[model samples]
Target: MLADELQHKIDFKTKPLGALGHLEYLAHQIGMVQNTVSPELSNPHMVVFAADHGIAASGVSAYPQEVTYQMVMNFLGGGAAINVFCRQHNIAIKIVDAGVNFDFPAGLELMDKKVRKSSRNILEEPAMTSEEYRQALENGKSVVSEIAKTGCNIMGFGEMGIGNTSASSLMMSRLFDLPIVSCIGRGTGLNDTQLLHKIRILSEAIEKYPHIETADEIAETFGGLEIVQMMGAMKEAYDQNMLIMVDGFIASIAVAAVWKKDPQILNNCIFCHVSDENAHQTLLELLGQKALLNLNLRLGEGTGCALAYPLIQSAVNFLNEMSSFEDAHVSNKE
Candidate 1:
């Protein structure tokens, strides 16, 4: 339950009654997350998880599997969109090799949490063995734990893996009990024929898992290395009471996996945006949540988090610095 006292503090702000609309709600939610009337934002970090999906070999994406590692190099060189947005906002960004196929030379600034070179193609078999899934979960937890130790209480998650949107679409269909067609989308610029092929492929892949009832099984059956690890990081962040900035569709699916296991995790999450991905709006509707923005954004490297960060700061700023009616000696509304 939210504290009644916090609600009172928000209502008593100097602005006209409810003038701030969702912003007031944003302030209250952040206040509740921190359990303080004067909540502060500190040490914001955006973590981008990179990996390769074996399903990528099934001709599901516009790009090659090598782009997974190539984009990781782009991230390290500070040339990707994520790097640009993070640098603009001064949010620290880190790349984790959750299960990318390539291995960088020693001394590269990256976290080596690879569980394997890539996942097993789900259409053919399980994406990963249970032990591998467990390791991915633990790796995610450790990464977030270390970040939290550095006084970072606000965090955002992103992912980069060719064909991962297929992985996400499959998980959404199964975990949320929706039709695979409703969950399908044009990931990475698929043409009409390619999109139809993707739907048929994923639909057949879903038939392979007839008995996945638990969260772990669902994850191992229909998740990428980056996504599974993201699920773990999300749970750990929620457990530690860290605010979660959820990116687009793939990131939302990761959060959904965690939420299915423990619904309370949604309390700390701020849905950053409704992605341009077709299934994203449906996913948000299923969660009964409103995203902060919708700029037709389909880029998925936590760009929504970066774009939304300033608004989050604004929420805190108004709560902490705005003039109260009494403080400004303004007449009360009649």
Candidate 2:
């Protein structure tokens, strides 16, 4: 049930019990999950799920909802920054139409998992119906399963939607019992008046909808197709004992959803980075995630995850390569 081989490798090659600090610990965790000291990080995949939110029309985000559609086009054309970075890092990127409102043209490997054309107006009502929420959950699980079948155990998730930060802020405020002031931020460059309006819109959303008592209730009301899908994917990864890397703020919200269902899911996650978003810290703290990086990055297209892969690889690499005082014939410290 434990990683004896990893312990053997660590004890045989490394310094003292943990001279390598967190790297030693990280290697141990990876080795245990992978069941080998000679563990390999196979096929790292990043799934950038695109969706449209009705809240965008209300001026929640500085950018228009059309950006989501246009961004997806950029992703398909390999013109996005994430695409370029992923290519440089050798991380395969897959773009999915989780619930982009636009009828994306054919040819991309688009998954048919759209819940609705788009989410309901958050100003008027909860985002999605309970049935739609369940469907989103299933679709998320299905995506992870597809990746697992492809021998990809380690996966990362990201999202693209204009008003999603507003939704995430609302979710953070409600889910963590934090004040809107602590969670809301100037998403996509909101001006002073627009920032104030964002705070007000989110505050009103909370007052109108109130707290969500269950996971399904939360996802049903506040979840996007992309967000809930990441939740389901993470749940599936946890169930299967695979490693799941979380991207930026919106991707991190999926982990919060997973915790909303089962708090123990944090064991399977390696939070890749901290974000500039104000609520991101609170959400990560609530999940008890001491994320691997504090890059102040708010770019939410698996960029953090891509940036984190080499760090993880380094941890694992050093674990298996670094020699002990005995092996190197060096003096040991007391």
Best-fitting candidate, measured by TM-score? Answer: 1
Model 1 bad stretches (over 4 Å): none
Give a tens-digit lDDT track for model 2, residues 263-302: 7777768889988887788777778777888888887988
- What TM-score should be assigned to candidate 1? 0.98
Candidate 1 clashes between residue pairs 3 or more apart in a chain or in different chains: none
Hey, what RMSD does candidate 1 come out at?
1.0
In order, the Cα lDDT scores of the candidates are 0.92, 0.81
When summed lDDT is taken over every stretch of 10 residues in candidate 1, the lowest stretch is 1-10
lDDT of 1 at 46: 99
For residue 81, model 1's alpha carbon misses the true position, in angstroms, by 0.7
**TM-score per model over all chains:** 0.98, 0.93
> Where does candidate 2 clash, by residue pair?
none
lDDT of 2 at 3: 71
